[model samples]
Target: MDLTGKVAIVTGSGQGLGLAYARELARRGAAVVVNDINADTANAAVAAITAEGGKAHAVTGAVGSTEVAQALVDGAVETFGRLDILVTNAGMLRDKVVWKMTDEDFDQVLNVHMRGTFTCVRAAAIRMREQGEGGRIICIGSPAGQRGNFGQTNYSGAKAGILGMVRTWAMELQRANITVNAVVPVAATAMTETVPFLKPYVEAMHNGEQLPSFARRELGFGGPEDAAGIVAFLAGDAAAEVTGQAVGVGGDRLALWSHPDMTTTAYHDGGWDAEAIEQEWPTTFADHLESVGEKLPEEASAQ
Candidate 1:
């Protein structure tokens, strides 16, 4: 996918998966605007791209801010001449079960991941529409959002909300040819390293040691580059028809995710009362009910 002369803004490109995405886009001949809240990290990314003879500019600011989002779009147009792709990867985690999660924790995560993505996409879409060329808007999602995770209500909620935006925007912007999609990446980034169960393996990988078979089996080959390829693919023209979907990327695996839909339904000529519904509930839907975190008993036993 040659992105020669394309301009892209990748938020939170200072490190980890975001950094990998920025580097890959730049490598593909895209002039990148690397946005990070941290100035040092942003500068380092910009320097690395320049060292490799790729064009890039650093924009440091909080992604959740409307002003910052607008500035990022403006910077790309001012520096690169026009904007063509936007990858909203800026996010933070505040893991806590619903009861223990504070307002601040929930708000911060939502603002950065959901609200920030909306702000950036809205800003970029305006320019893309006016420029008269379609654009690609890719938002970062998480497995935690698809299937709920313990102690991650805030993070999961925000990530799931982002997917919703991806679907909505994909349809809303289709007329302008702007495609919006979500990518759920599983990699050993700083974010995953925070999980106690994955920490040892992630640290070992960082030290160049081979991961245990179980870790390898569960998380696949763990690295940010593993996820970057998919993001780059979606940002290119080849994926113009691949909007409104969630794609999973990890190791050498790439999978398409199914959207929510009605699997089964019960109908009554007249709406049944609570008591009447309770009487028919078992025959109506119990057999099809699914467990939260696992397959049906028959499938689980087979596995």
Candidate 2:
């Protein structure tokens, strides 16, 4: 895929997965706007790209607010002359079980992942529609979001909300040719490298030690750059019609996650009364109940 002459914006691009995405898009010839809360990392990301003969500019800001979102879109247009791609990769994590979680904890994650996604997407969609050209909006997702993870009430909720919006926006923006999709990536990034059980694996990867084959093949785990190519593909012409999809990618594996759909159906003329449903529930629904939680190999923590 090629992105020559395209101007793109990648939020939270100062480091980790976002940094990988920014570098990938720029490598494919897009003029990138690298956004992050930290000015140092943002500038450094820009430098890294430009040093490789790719075009990039830094826009430093946290992404949840409308003002910051607008500035990001504006940065792309004013700096590079047009906006064609947007990768909503900025996020923060506050892990705690539901009972131990605070209102601040819940809201912080929501504001960054879900609300930030909405506002940035709204801003980008408006600009893209105005330009009368199709654009790409790639929102990030997680296994936690798809299959509820332990101690990630806020994160799961926020990411699930992103995929939900992607589906809705896909339908809404179809006429404009703007493709909106979500990427569910599992990689060794800043957000995940700290997990107690995975710390060893993360450290090993960093030390250039080869991990077990299962880690990359089954767990779909690896460095952030391994998942970066999918972002570049989704942002290019080849994926113009590929919208509302939630694709998973990591080391040695790529997958397409199924959208939520009913796996079983039952009929009730008017509606079954509580007693009748209780009597039939086990036979009708119990056998079909889907299990939840991230499907991890026995070696990792549930989260």
Candidate 3:
């Protein structure tokens, strides 16, 4: 994990998971650029890194803006001479069900999580290609994107979009040896505060079985450090060949995501006939329910 002579930029690095990633990367010798919306937090992180004998600078700005995201990349190269790693860790949450969600809430999450990630990755990838050197692009994602959550339609959409972007960008940038990967971190952080109801669900998702309310307290929840290690690995040379992948990080719950089974083909030939399926699958709906059993509860599917 020695990143000596390498320059890294971590968005939202002023606190929480992003700060952990920046600090650990700097400790391993990467000259870090800590970006945050709060000037004081960003400055504090940078100062701490410097005090520990690491190279770092603070950039305070909203990551959701294209200008600020680009500035972070450009600032790294301008101050440190090159950009080697770009971590899109900046994010905010607006919790609401689809019916309860507002236009503003949806737009805000999409802007920060999806557009902000694209902005930094686009800027850094172009620079890396121009420099004729391989680079690492790491994005922070969440489990809600993989498995739909009850009240996070906006956040899920944005994070799912990130997974798609990472896959495509990996193919596009592979020629230049720049890898794009994402981490579905279930670690407790600021973002989790907005989804208090989902905390139990997340615990069940990690623990693999529903726990009694009294025993739930004993279920392990990960911290920022747990996520930072995986991010560091992805940002380092050790993971050079790993690209276009989404990895989940939870204590005792590290595994590739499980995709929704798509065996129910509604097409006969080259096209789908909605009318035909409506007639043919009169019993199909019941069969599907029996097939999935308790996983697809009647009340849950009503939504």
Q: Give lDDT per model, in order.
A: 0.87, 0.93, 0.81
lDDT tens per residue, model 2, 1-303 = 889999999999999999999999999999999999999989999999999999999999999999999999999999999999999999999999999999999999999999999999999999999999889999999988999988999999999999999999999999999999999998998898867767877898999998778788878888999999999999999998899999999888999999999998777888889987888889889999899986567766553
lDDT of 2: 0.93
- List RMSD in Å for every model shown: 3.0, 1.4, 5.4
Worst 10 residues of 3 by lDDT: 291-300
Model 3: per-residue Cα lDDT over 90-209, one tens digit each: 998888879999999999999999999998888999899998989999998877777667778898899889998998999999999999999888666667644544365455646666
Error of 3 at 275 (Å): 4.8
Model 1, span 22-84: residue lDDT tens = 999999999999988989989999999899989999999989989999999999988989999
Q: The CA-based lDDT of model 3 is what?
A: 0.81
TM-score of 1: 0.93
Model 3 lDDT at residue 244: 88
In candidate 3, stretches whose alpha carbon ends up further than 4 angstroms from where it belongs are 197-220, 258-261, 266-275, 282-303
lDDT for model 1 comes to 0.87
TM-score (all chains, Cα) for each model: 0.93, 0.97, 0.84
User: What residue pairs are clashing in model 2?
Assistant: none
- Say what the RMSD of model 2 is: 1.4
